[model samples]
Target: MAAVPLRRPLDAETVVVPVGQVFVIPERCKGCRFCIEFCPEQVLVESDRMNAKGYRYPVVADGKERACVNCGFCRLICPEFAIYTEEIR
Candidate 1:
Protein backbone atom coordinates (compact mmCIF):
# COMPACT_ATOMS: atom_id res chain seq x y z
CA MET A 1 0.00 0.00 0.00
CA ALA A 2 1.10 3.59 -0.66
CA ALA A 3 0.94 6.40 1.90
CA VAL A 4 -1.48 9.22 1.19
CA PRO A 5 -0.63 12.82 2.02
CA LEU A 6 -3.07 14.69 4.21
CA ARG A 7 -2.69 17.93 2.32
CA ARG A 8 -1.09 19.51 -0.74
CA PRO A 9 1.26 22.47 -0.71
CA LEU A 10 -0.19 25.85 -1.51
CA ASP A 11 1.19 27.78 -4.43
CA ALA A 12 3.54 30.65 -3.56
CA GLU A 13 1.38 33.37 -5.12
CA THR A 14 -1.58 32.71 -2.84
CA VAL A 15 0.23 33.27 0.42
CA VAL A 16 -0.01 36.73 1.91
CA VAL A 17 1.00 37.18 5.52
CA PRO A 18 -0.55 40.16 7.27
CA VAL A 19 1.58 42.51 9.35
CA GLY A 20 0.84 45.14 11.97
CA GLN A 21 2.11 47.00 14.98
CA VAL A 22 1.12 46.07 18.49
CA PHE A 23 0.36 48.62 21.16
CA VAL A 24 -0.29 48.33 24.86
CA ILE A 25 -1.37 50.53 27.72
CA PRO A 26 1.01 49.39 30.41
CA GLU A 27 -0.90 51.08 33.18
CA ARG A 28 -4.19 49.57 32.07
CA CYS A 29 -2.75 46.08 32.07
CA LYS A 30 -3.22 44.19 35.31
CA GLY A 31 -0.56 41.50 34.77
CA CYS A 32 -3.13 39.16 33.32
CA ARG A 33 -1.66 36.96 30.61
CA PHE A 34 -4.70 36.56 28.38
CA CYS A 35 -3.38 38.61 25.48
CA ILE A 36 0.06 37.06 25.61
CA GLU A 37 -1.22 33.56 26.16
CA PHE A 38 -3.91 33.65 23.49
CA CYS A 39 -2.17 35.53 20.67
CA PRO A 40 -2.32 33.30 17.62
CA GLU A 41 0.95 34.78 16.37
CA GLN A 42 2.58 34.50 19.82
CA VAL A 43 4.08 37.93 19.23
CA LEU A 44 4.02 39.24 22.77
CA VAL A 45 5.95 38.68 26.00
CA GLU A 46 6.26 40.11 29.48
CA SER A 47 8.50 43.16 29.67
CA ASP A 48 11.18 43.62 32.34
CA ARG A 49 9.68 46.94 33.40
CA MET A 50 6.62 47.07 35.61
CA ASN A 51 3.78 49.55 35.45
CA ALA A 52 2.74 51.89 38.25
CA LYS A 53 0.64 49.06 39.60
CA GLY A 54 3.66 46.77 39.66
CA TYR A 55 2.20 44.60 36.94
CA ARG A 56 4.31 43.33 34.09
CA TYR A 57 2.68 44.13 30.74
CA PRO A 58 3.03 42.61 27.30
CA VAL A 59 5.56 43.90 24.77
CA VAL A 60 6.54 42.78 21.33
CA ALA A 61 9.11 40.07 21.77
CA ASP A 62 12.62 40.90 20.58
CA GLY A 63 13.10 40.72 16.81
CA LYS A 64 9.36 40.21 16.38
CA GLU A 65 8.38 43.65 15.09
CA ARG A 66 7.00 42.27 11.84
CA ALA A 67 5.45 39.18 13.36
CA CYS A 68 2.09 40.61 14.29
CA VAL A 69 -0.61 39.68 11.77
CA ASN A 70 -3.14 42.33 12.83
CA CYS A 71 -5.65 39.62 13.62
CA GLY A 72 -6.98 41.54 16.62
CA PHE A 73 -7.11 38.35 18.67
CA CYS A 74 -5.22 40.05 21.46
CA ARG A 75 -7.55 43.02 21.37
CA LEU A 76 -10.54 40.75 21.41
CA ILE A 77 -9.25 38.67 24.30
CA CYS A 78 -7.86 41.40 26.51
CA PRO A 79 -10.25 42.09 29.38
CA GLU A 80 -8.45 45.28 30.32
CA PHE A 81 -8.36 46.57 26.73
CA ALA A 82 -4.65 47.25 27.06
CA ILE A 83 -3.57 45.58 23.83
CA TYR A 84 -4.37 46.45 20.21
CA THR A 85 -2.95 46.45 16.69
CA GLU A 86 -2.92 48.70 13.66
CA GLU A 87 -2.13 47.89 10.06
CA ILE A 88 1.45 48.69 9.16
CA ARG A 89 0.44 50.57 6.04
Candidate 2:
Protein backbone atom coordinates (compact mmCIF):
# COMPACT_ATOMS: atom_id res chain seq x y z
CA MET A 1 0.00 0.00 0.00
CA ALA A 2 1.22 3.52 -0.84
CA ALA A 3 0.79 6.49 1.49
CA VAL A 4 -0.61 9.80 0.23
CA PRO A 5 -0.30 13.25 1.72
CA LEU A 6 -3.44 15.25 2.41
CA ARG A 7 -3.78 18.87 1.33
CA ARG A 8 -5.39 21.51 3.53
CA PRO A 9 -8.39 23.43 2.29
CA LEU A 10 -7.88 27.04 1.37
CA ASP A 11 -9.58 29.70 3.49
CA ALA A 12 -11.77 32.06 1.46
CA GLU A 13 -11.53 34.93 3.97
CA THR A 14 -7.74 34.97 3.95
CA VAL A 15 -7.56 35.31 0.18
CA VAL A 16 -7.08 38.72 -1.42
CA VAL A 17 -10.34 38.71 -3.33
CA PRO A 18 -10.81 40.80 -6.46
CA VAL A 19 -13.71 43.22 -6.35
CA GLY A 20 -15.58 44.64 -9.31
CA GLN A 21 -17.45 47.88 -9.96
CA VAL A 22 -20.09 47.48 -12.62
CA PHE A 23 -20.88 50.36 -14.93
CA VAL A 24 -24.17 50.62 -16.75
CA ILE A 25 -24.54 53.04 -19.61
CA PRO A 26 -28.22 53.89 -19.43
CA GLU A 27 -28.50 55.49 -22.82
CA ARG A 28 -26.81 52.59 -24.48
CA CYS A 29 -28.68 49.88 -22.61
CA LYS A 30 -31.55 48.23 -24.50
CA GLY A 31 -33.38 46.99 -21.39
CA CYS A 32 -31.91 43.56 -21.82
CA ARG A 33 -31.54 41.57 -18.62
CA PHE A 34 -28.62 39.60 -20.02
CA CYS A 35 -26.23 41.23 -17.59
CA ILE A 36 -28.42 40.49 -14.61
CA GLU A 37 -29.39 37.05 -15.82
CA PHE A 38 -25.85 36.04 -16.69
CA CYS A 39 -24.17 37.40 -13.61
CA PRO A 40 -22.78 34.43 -11.73
CA GLU A 41 -22.79 36.35 -8.48
CA GLN A 42 -26.33 37.72 -8.93
CA VAL A 43 -24.97 41.15 -8.09
CA LEU A 44 -27.14 43.08 -10.54
CA VAL A 45 -30.88 43.73 -10.88
CA GLU A 46 -33.21 45.70 -13.09
CA SER A 47 -33.70 49.24 -11.87
CA ASP A 48 -37.17 50.78 -11.75
CA ARG A 49 -35.67 53.89 -13.25
CA MET A 50 -35.64 54.39 -16.98
CA ASN A 51 -32.98 55.82 -19.19
CA ALA A 52 -33.26 58.60 -21.76
CA LYS A 53 -34.04 55.85 -24.26
CA GLY A 54 -36.78 54.56 -21.95
CA TYR A 55 -34.92 51.42 -21.08
CA ARG A 56 -34.47 49.89 -17.66
CA TYR A 57 -30.81 49.47 -16.79
CA PRO A 58 -29.09 47.21 -14.36
CA VAL A 59 -28.10 48.27 -10.87
CA VAL A 60 -26.22 46.53 -8.14
CA ALA A 61 -28.55 44.58 -5.94
CA ASP A 62 -29.22 45.79 -2.42
CA GLY A 63 -26.92 44.44 0.31
CA LYS A 64 -24.52 43.15 -2.37
CA GLU A 65 -21.42 45.02 -1.35
CA ARG A 66 -18.33 43.86 -3.23
CA ALA A 67 -20.41 41.26 -5.03
CA CYS A 68 -19.07 41.52 -8.57
CA VAL A 69 -16.17 39.27 -9.52
CA ASN A 70 -15.12 41.22 -12.67
CA CYS A 71 -15.65 38.16 -14.85
CA GLY A 72 -16.76 40.39 -17.81
CA PHE A 73 -19.66 38.10 -18.60
CA CYS A 74 -22.06 41.03 -18.60
CA ARG A 75 -19.98 42.98 -21.07
CA LEU A 76 -19.59 39.99 -23.33
CA ILE A 77 -23.25 39.07 -23.35
CA CYS A 78 -24.52 42.61 -23.79
CA PRO A 79 -25.54 43.26 -27.36
CA GLU A 80 -25.45 47.01 -26.81
CA PHE A 81 -22.10 47.14 -25.05
CA ALA A 82 -23.85 48.97 -22.24
CA ILE A 83 -22.48 47.05 -19.24
CA TYR A 84 -18.90 46.67 -18.09
CA THR A 85 -16.85 46.16 -14.94
CA GLU A 86 -13.73 47.65 -13.44
CA GLU A 87 -11.53 46.22 -10.71
CA ILE A 88 -11.79 47.96 -7.39
CA ARG A 89 -8.58 49.02 -5.72
Candidate 3:
Protein backbone atom coordinates (compact mmCIF):
# COMPACT_ATOMS: atom_id res chain seq x y z
CA MET A 1 0.00 0.00 0.00
CA ALA A 2 1.24 3.50 -0.84
CA ALA A 3 1.80 5.90 2.10
CA VAL A 4 -0.55 8.88 2.27
CA PRO A 5 0.90 12.38 2.08
CA LEU A 6 0.68 14.52 5.22
CA ARG A 7 -0.52 18.12 5.19
CA ARG A 8 0.45 20.86 7.64
CA PRO A 9 -1.87 23.53 8.90
CA LEU A 10 -0.92 27.14 8.46
CA ASP A 11 -0.18 29.18 11.56
CA ALA A 12 -2.08 32.42 12.17
CA GLU A 13 -0.13 35.41 13.44
CA THR A 14 -0.78 39.11 13.82
CA VAL A 15 1.24 41.37 11.58
CA VAL A 16 3.51 43.66 13.58
CA VAL A 17 3.97 46.93 11.76
CA PRO A 18 6.78 49.31 12.62
CA VAL A 19 6.01 52.72 14.01
CA GLY A 20 5.44 54.69 10.81
CA GLN A 21 3.99 58.09 10.02
CA VAL A 22 2.60 59.96 7.02
CA PHE A 23 2.63 63.51 5.70
CA VAL A 24 0.35 65.28 3.25
CA ILE A 25 1.75 67.77 0.80
CA PRO A 26 -0.69 70.63 0.27
CA GLU A 27 1.03 71.69 -2.92
CA ARG A 28 0.99 68.17 -4.33
CA CYS A 29 -2.36 67.10 -2.97
CA LYS A 30 -5.28 67.52 -5.35
CA GLY A 31 -7.77 66.97 -2.47
CA CYS A 32 -9.20 63.84 -4.02
CA ARG A 33 -9.96 62.20 -0.62
CA PHE A 34 -8.49 58.96 -1.87
CA CYS A 35 -6.25 58.81 1.20
CA ILE A 36 -9.06 59.73 3.57
CA GLU A 37 -11.28 56.89 2.43
CA PHE A 38 -8.55 54.35 1.92
CA CYS A 39 -6.70 54.95 5.22
CA PRO A 40 -7.59 52.07 7.54
CA GLU A 41 -6.88 54.15 10.65
CA GLN A 42 -9.11 56.99 9.42
CA VAL A 43 -6.30 59.36 10.39
CA LEU A 44 -6.84 61.62 7.38
CA VAL A 45 -10.00 63.75 7.13
CA GLU A 46 -11.47 66.35 4.79
CA SER A 47 -10.90 69.95 5.76
CA ASP A 48 -13.45 72.78 5.65
CA ARG A 49 -12.94 73.50 1.96
CA MET A 50 -11.15 72.35 -1.17
CA ASN A 51 -7.73 73.16 -2.47
CA ALA A 52 -6.71 75.63 -5.20
CA LYS A 53 -7.67 73.03 -7.78
CA GLY A 54 -11.14 72.75 -6.23
CA TYR A 55 -10.59 69.37 -4.59
CA ARG A 56 -11.11 68.21 -1.02
CA TYR A 57 -7.67 67.89 0.58
CA PRO A 58 -6.93 65.35 3.33
CA VAL A 59 -5.50 66.31 6.72
CA VAL A 60 -4.63 64.50 9.90
CA ALA A 61 -7.55 64.83 12.24
CA ASP A 62 -8.52 63.49 15.68
CA GLY A 63 -5.72 61.34 17.16
CA LYS A 64 -2.38 62.68 16.06
CA GLU A 65 -0.26 59.54 16.47
CA ARG A 66 -2.62 56.67 17.25
CA ALA A 67 -4.90 57.42 14.31
CA CYS A 68 -2.43 56.91 11.46
CA VAL A 69 -0.90 53.43 11.27
CA ASN A 70 1.42 54.41 8.44
CA CYS A 71 0.14 51.53 6.39
CA GLY A 72 0.57 53.58 3.25
CA PHE A 73 -2.91 52.55 2.16
CA CYS A 74 -3.80 56.07 1.17
CA ARG A 75 -0.58 56.61 -0.72
CA LEU A 76 -1.12 53.49 -2.77
CA ILE A 77 -4.83 54.02 -3.36
CA CYS A 78 -4.43 57.64 -4.31
CA PRO A 79 -4.43 58.28 -8.03
CA GLU A 80 -2.31 61.34 -7.40
CA PHE A 81 -0.11 59.47 -4.88
CA ALA A 82 0.18 62.59 -2.80
CA ILE A 83 0.32 60.76 0.52
CA TYR A 84 3.79 60.20 2.06
CA THR A 85 5.01 58.38 5.16
CA GLU A 86 7.88 59.24 7.52
CA GLU A 87 9.65 57.01 10.00
CA ILE A 88 10.18 58.28 13.50
CA ARG A 89 13.86 58.48 14.35
Candidate 3: lDDT of 49? 71
- Tell me the lDDT of candidate 3: 0.71
30-53: candidate 3 lDDT, tens digit per residue: 766777776777787887776777
Cα RMSD (angstroms) for every candidate in the order listed: 2.8, 5.6, 8.2
User: If the candidates were sorted by their TM-score against the true structure, best first, what order would they fall in?
Assistant: 1, 2, 3
What TM-score would every model get versus the actual structure? 0.84, 0.80, 0.64
* lDDT of every model, 2 decimals: 0.90, 0.88, 0.71
* CA error at residue 40 for candidate 2, angstroms: 0.1
Choose the strongest candidate by TM-score.
1
Between candidates 1 and 2, the one scoring higher on TM-score is: 1
Residue ranges of candidate 3 with Cα displaced over 4 Å: 1-17
Stretch of 10 with least lDDT, candidate 3: 8-17
How far is 70's C-alpha from truth in model 3 (Å)? 1.8
Best by lDDT: 1
Quote model 3's TM-score: 0.64
Clashing pairs in 2: none
